[model samples]
Target: MKKLLLTAGISALLATSAVAQTIGVSVARFDDNGLTIMRNGMTDHVDTLDGVDLQVEDAQDDVARQLDQINNFVASGVDAIIVNAVDTNATDAMSVAAASAGIPLVYVNRQPINMDTLPDGQAFVASNEVESGTLAAFQMCQDLRAQGKSGGAQAYMLMGQLSNQAAVQRSKDFHDVIGMDMCNFITLIDEQTANWSRDEAQDMMTNWISSGEPFDAVFANNDEMAIGAIQAMKASGLSMEEIVVGGVDATADALVAMQAGELDVTVFQDLAGQGAGSIDTALKLAAGEEVDKTVFIPFKLVTPENVADFLN
Candidate 1:
């Protein structure tokens, strides 16, 4: 009887030791196409791990709600947490909450404002913003020159949500690229934010079309907005061949647009890779292992010539 009791106790201890590590994830919103792919990647990758559990929540694009989720994760004693921030500038409180609780935190896809000041066991995982818009705009510049627009060309800009770091950097990238001598012939006629909404972008594009501006190109911060602009131009009876359209995030819909000869250029930001990397980083951090504070997945330029290679 004594031996049996000892054996039972050992088995119980082994079972306890095999308990899965839990990770709490708070995404900015679940309805976003690109972010949905990322969130799916996280869930799929976790499924492959031996002892891991993921608890995902949508912050619904609310800063206060995202902070509350972080606090809740801490209170629940999760081993680690991953956040796809709604407002990149509003992440200081989230970082502090995770740090105070001694839990590992990883910021995925979106950059946090306090990145440079992130405490121990915290990191950011995403593609480099500098590369995203620069690639698209530079490619657009080249495509315009190829089409004999080198003499001079006027273009409109469609920006993403202003609060997100990616949007700010991507917008800056477009301006910087256009400022270069090689691309200086391109003129930016007007710029506006669509708040990363397709419907808003379509409405904004329709308004621009109503202005009867003879723009040569449209540079958008992301594929959804680019698609929106395309839809608006089509509705206005503007030929796709007449204007060069460029955007970041070579999404499936964007690739379809490229195949249909509508979208001219885009930059491929690996949504899945960023998602998986965040999980790996979070797991490492949870285990008290050293990891880079920032992990960047490289961005690739996509055009009609090689768009097929990027198709789903």
Candidate 2:
């Protein structure tokens, strides 16, 4: 009986060792709020699977770094490879490498523009960015109208990486959303891409203010930019209430500002679920379990009235 018990214990140890499948999860940049939430989700998912280990990589929005990371993951023989591309077109080589190595690749958040179709044994998931951008635009415009402002009112658009498919679609959706008859007088004074950097956004806003650009509202593409816009506002001797501030990706900081009446409105892109779902799907695919071909998280507008419910 003792011998049998020892054998059982040994089997259990072996089973434990076989759990967390090796996965290489990556993102374009770690500085953005949306990416942080997705990373959190991925880590949480990894924890749930006993043997599943997620190797998270931040490309810092550089193609070379991303390419190197992808190559390393392939060389390391990670069971699965995942990426949020820095340059969608440039990522073809990584996909090709993955195919040659027999490793499955998954693209998260941003879809590749150059790769018309994904290779077999690969999948993609993302938030419905059109809804997020439209909601953000709608909220900001409503707030401006509430202030009895309309027609020819200048606004500035601070945006994300132009190369990203999500960024491009979001920007397009924002313009479409704001193209209502009521807002015909609205003038987008400047629509420059910020690469979603807070410091860069601050510098741009400072320059715009210095140039005496006649704009009242600042529509930053992401929450980080909105926060940076706040710094710019303060630096420019303007209060938060001086202009209608809007953003996407409702991170904790942005939510706090909303509760404190500092920020006007934003859209919650539900970033946390991204990483977790990606891991779950990748593992399922590796294990020969069924998984969705495409999973898209939803977006919701966040305002002062709903902020309490959201926070709690």
TM-score of each prediction: 0.97, 0.90
- The TM-score, computed over Cα atoms with residue i paired to residue i, of candidate 1 is 0.97
lDDT of 1 by residue, 60-139 (tens): 99999999999999999999999999999998999999999999999999999999999999999999999999999999
lDDT of 2 by residue, 1-312 (tens): 999999999999898877647999778888767788888888876776677787889998889999899889999988898888887667678778787887877778777664466666677777877888888888788888887787457788888888877778778876886688866666788888888888888888888889887777888888888888788878778767758888888889999978777778888877778777777777777776656667788888998878876784
- Against the true structure, whose lDDT is highest? 1
- Supply candidate 2's per-residue lDDT for 108: 81
Candidate 2 lDDT for residue 113: 60
Could you tell me the C-alpha RMSD of candidate 2 in Å?
A: 2.3
Global CA lDDT of candidate 1, please? 0.94
RMSD for all candidates, in order, please. 1.5, 2.3
Model 2 segments more than 4 A misplaced:
1-20, 114-116
Backbone clashes, each candidate: 0, 9
